[model samples]
Target: MLDATTITAPIFIEDMEVGLTRHLEKIISDHDISLFAEVSEDRNPVHLNDEYAESTMFGGRIAHGMLTAALISAVIGEQLPGHGTVYLRQSMAFLAPVRPGDLVRAEVEVKSIDLRRSRVTLDTRCLVDETRVLHGEALVLAPSRG
Candidate 1:
């Protein structure tokens, strides 16, 4: 029996179409940096130690590139193809550093939809204000209707 405590993310891909887009914004905070560092075990000095990072090319602490890119995943999973979508592949390029407290805006736009194969191709990008910090492409298996 389905109970109140049971979690569910229903498949909603039948109506998926090309050109659809979604956006997600988040402030990447100091606490966020610390927590992501811990969870990802990416204790890189550039991403964790302000003093050490000051000597690096970025000149100070910076968030992990993947941490910024993860926002793309959030947009895809929660809003684009949306809940229950299965990720098949992703490719990204990091363009700039995201320092603490930057408001990262992530957007994903569906570039194509192959309904026969239940596949969706999306263009993804993350920006700090008008500056793009990351850009990528993602291919996902849009859930098939039974």
Candidate 2:
């Protein structure tokens, strides 16, 4: 098991700055949608059924919004304040639907930092081409130097 006390955060709180940004990209695939549906138990037809989805407002099956949002989490944990950071809360707004095969780009920017509390707030977003599919803010406890 990993020990939190001994493990140092990849980027310490003192090193972070406003406007620091990182991006990650992935193509939403049929396999991804299916696995996410299975893992989340969100068998919504709009995400899994073709004909049924065609009857809806979107007119096509789409990837689960949370699946796209997961990319934002990836950018945070693997990129920006990477590794040892701890997520406190996330507020998301789903702006558009992401269809399978869409190339999703997740971006995160450090908006504010509270070094005294070892916390940081970031602006998070996911885009498909020029369209924003999801946007949000995330609060996390950053790793410390000491």
TM-score of each: 0.89, 0.93
**Residue 17 lDDT in model 1?**
69
Candidates in order have lDDT scores of 0.85, 0.91
lDDT score for residue 81 of model 1: 70
* Candidate 1 weakest lDDT stretch, 10 residues: 1-10
lDDT of 2 by residue, 32-63 (tens): 99999999999999999999999999999999
Per residue, candidate 1 scores C-alpha lDDT tens digits across 1-146 of 12435554633567766777888889999999999989999999898898999999999999999989888987777667766789999999999999999999999988888877888899999999999999999999876665
- The residue ranges of model 1 lying beyond 4 angstroms of the native Cα positions read 1-11
